[model samples]
Target: MNTAINSRIPVALTIAGSDSGGGAGIQADLRTFAFHCVHGTSAITCVTAQNTLGVRRVDAMPMEAVVAQIQAVVEDIGVQAAKTGMLLNQEIIFAVAQQVEALQINNLVVDPVMVSRTGAQLIDDDAVKTLCHTLIPKAVIITPNRYEAQILSGLQINSLEDMQAAAEIIHKTLRTKAVLVKGGGMQGDLRGVDIWFDGDKLEVLTTKQVETKNTHGTGCTLSAAIAANLAKGKDLWQAVQQAKEYVTTALTYALDIGEGQGPVGHFFPLWGLGTGDWELGKKQGSREQGAG
Candidate 1:
C-alpha cells in the first residue's frame, strides 16, 4: 500500500484472453508492457490451448468473472490505459463495454479480434454486432486487421486506397476516436502499411517489413505497446507512431522457435546485451546448412 512508489509507475490493463502458447493474447500484452516499463494488469476473458502452430481449444470465462476482474483492477491498482482482445462472445463483449463505461476507463485501445489476418471470421454475427455497437465506440482507437476492417467497413481492401477508404468508413460508422486499418495480411508493396484515420486527419503509417514467418503476435504486441505508451502519458498519435516503431524492431529480432510461426522478440533490447546476436546466429546456421 505504498502510494508513493505505485504512483510513479504507470499501470496498464489488458482485458484479453490467455494464450497458453505464450505468443499472443495476454502473454504478448504483458511482455510488451514490461518492455515499456509499465505495470501490466490483466483480466483474462478466456483460456486458449494453443501454440505457434495453431489454437487447439478455447474456453471463455463467465461474464461475471470478467466483470469482477476489471472491477478489481480498476478499483485498486488503478489503470492509466487499457486494451481488449478476443472477447469471444456477446456476453463478454457486453459486460466489458458496461465495465468500461461504469469504471470510466479512458485511453482505451480496442483490437477488434473478430477476424483473423487470413480473412477468417472468429466471432459469430451476434458477438460482432454487440462489439461494434457497445464496445468499439467506447474505445479511443480501434486496431483492426485487413479482414476485420473489411467486415467493419463493408469494403474490400486490395490497395492502399482501399485501406484508406476502409479506415474512413470504420471511423465514420464505428464513431471511435480513430481507426487503424492494418495491412499485415496484405501482399507485396501493400504489406506493413497501416492506414490511420481520426475524424479530422487521415495518415498513412508505414514501417520496414521484416521478412519472417514469425509474426504470430504482431497485432497483440502493437496494440499493447500503444496502451503502454498511453499509460506513460503519450498522446494518441505519438503512442501509435512509437508503437509501430517498437513492433518493427521486435519483428527484426523475431524469435525462431516452435514448429510453426514464432513470435516477435518483445524483449529485443535485452537480448544478449542488446547485440541481438541470436538473429545473426540464425542466419549463420541457415547459410552453413545450405553450404553443407
Candidate 2:
C-alpha cells in the first residue's frame, strides 16, 4: 500500500465481536465500511461460534485485550469515525467507553446491541446498564432496535407514536446527541419504519420494506454504514439517511446462503462479479467460441 494514498483514505473503526458465521458483528461492519469506500478497522471484543441457525457459544476477550486493540488502531491509523457493537459484558463496555473518552472519538455511532430485534436480551442487565450510563452518552448517535429502545426509554413500542416517544426519551435521558429508534422488529406496516430525534428536530423515516428473512446483519450494517458516511464527512442527518438507504438496498440483495437466516449483501454491487466468477465466465465464453 502506498503510505501517502492510504493516509488520505477515510478510515472507520468497529469495536465489536467477531461472528464466525461471517454474517454479523465484525464481519458485517467491515464489509459495510468497505462497501462505502471507507477503510475499516476493528477491535474484537469477543468471538462467537455461530451460524445462520443461531449462536452456539460466545467467548469474550479480556477487558485489557479489548482496550489494547482499540489503542493500537486509534493511536496509529487514527479513524475518522468509529462504532461499537456487541461489547459482550460490563467490563468490556466500560473499558470501551473509557477508551472512547480517552481517545476523544467524537464521531461515534453506538449500535446498542443489548437486545435482539426479537425481544431477547443478548447482554446481561449490568452490561446493558454500563452501556447506557458509560458508553451511550459519548456517542454521536445511537441505533436501537425496538426492544432496545424500550429498555433505554422505559416505554413499550407498539406503534409509530411509541417509537417517536422512545427516541425522544432516549435522547433526553441517555444524554446522547441523537437517537434512532429502529423499527425492523416491528410488525405489519411499521416493520421498516424508523424514528429519529436529535434534541432539536424529530423525523419519521420510512423506506420501502424489502421482504426477506436474510436480515441477520441489518443492524450492524446500518450502524457501520452510518459511521462510514461520517468518516466520509457527512453530517449526522445525512449519514443516517444514507445508511438507511444503503441497508435497504442491500437487503434487496440479501444473500441466501445459510440454512437459516442469512445476511444482507454488504457488497451488492459485486454480486456475481467476483474475480473467480469473472475468470470462469471468460473461460466458458472462450470455450463456446472454440466450439463455434
Candidate 3:
C-alpha cells in the first residue's frame, strides 16, 4: 500500500510522450488521473507537434533525459502504478525497460502505441522489436488496440475468436500477466467488444459504442484510468472493468471542441449537465436539505 505519510494519495506514473494539442499522450494521462482522483506523475519520452488532425513532427527525447525523469520520480515520490506509451524508438524503449526492471515497478500497464488506424506504422521496426523483447514482458497488463495486437501477435483479428487468438498469442509471446485486445476499431457490432486474456481466464468486456468522432485520446485515457484504478488498490479485473466504465462515460460526453477528432470528456462529471430528471431531483433534495 503506497500511502504517503501526510497525503496518503494514490500515485500513478505515466512514461509517455507529450501531445502539444493536449488531447493525447501525457496530457490525456494526467487528465485521466485527475478524473480518478489520483496523483499523476509523468516522464515524457517524446515531444510531438500534433492536433486532432495528425502528428506533424515528433522529437524523441534523449535516453538519458527519459531515464533521469523516471528515476527522479521513483526515487522520491514512489509510484504505486505506472504505464508506458509512445516510446518512439529502440533507445527509449530499452532505457525504460531497464529502469522499470531496476526499480521493480510491479503494477505496470503497457499501451503499445505503434500504428495508426490507416495501418501506418508509427514507430520503427527496431523499436517494435525492443518493445516485444523488453517492455511488454515487464507489464502486469497490456492494452493494445486491434492494429497493435495484430502487429504484436501477427494475427489478423476479423472476429471475436480472432481477437481471442491474438490475445493468446500476445500473452504467450510477450509474457505479460494479462492482455486486452481492444475492438474499438472494428466495424459493425464488433466495435465495442474488447477481449481480455489472463492465461487462465478469457473475458469479453463490452460497452455501447458512442456515435461520435470526438475520440482522439481514448487509448491513452483508458490505459491511464486502468493504472489509476490499480493505484487505488483494485484487483486487475476490477481495474480494467472500472477503466472501461470510465472510458464509456467519457465517450458518452465526448468533447466537440476540435475540427477533427476531439478529445473525450475527461472531466465530464465535473462539467457535463446531468440528465434532466436526475438534475432536478438533486436540486430538490438539496433545497429540502437546506444545501446548495
The best candidate in terms of TM-score: 1
The digit string of per-residue lDDT tens for model 3 on 173-202 reads 899999999988888999878999999999
User: Model 2 — TM-score against the truth?
Assistant: 0.92
- Please provide, for model 2 over 246-279, each residue's C-alpha lDDT reduced to its tens digit, 9 standing for 90 to 100: 9987787676777999887687667456457644
Per-model TM values vs. the true structure: 0.93, 0.92, 0.91
Clashes of each: 0, 0, 0
| Candidate 1 Cα RMSD after full superposition onto the native fold (Å) | 3.4
TM-score for predicted model 1 compared with the true structure: 0.93
lDDT of each: 0.90, 0.89, 0.88
The whole-model C-alpha lDDT of candidate 3 against the native structure comes to: 0.88
**lDDT ranking of the models:** 1, 2, 3
Clashing pairs in 1: none
lDDT tens per residue, model 1, 1-292: 1112356899999999999989999999999999999999999999999999999999999999999999988888888899999899999999999999988899999999999888789999999999999999999999999999999999988999999999999999999999999889999988999999998899999887677788889999999999999999999999999999999888877777889988887887775566767666556434532211
Error of 2 at 237 (Å): 0.4
TM-score pick, better of 1 and 3? 1
Q: Which ranges of candidate 1 are over 4 A from the true structure?
A: 1-5, 274-292
Cα RMSD of predicted structure 3: 5.7
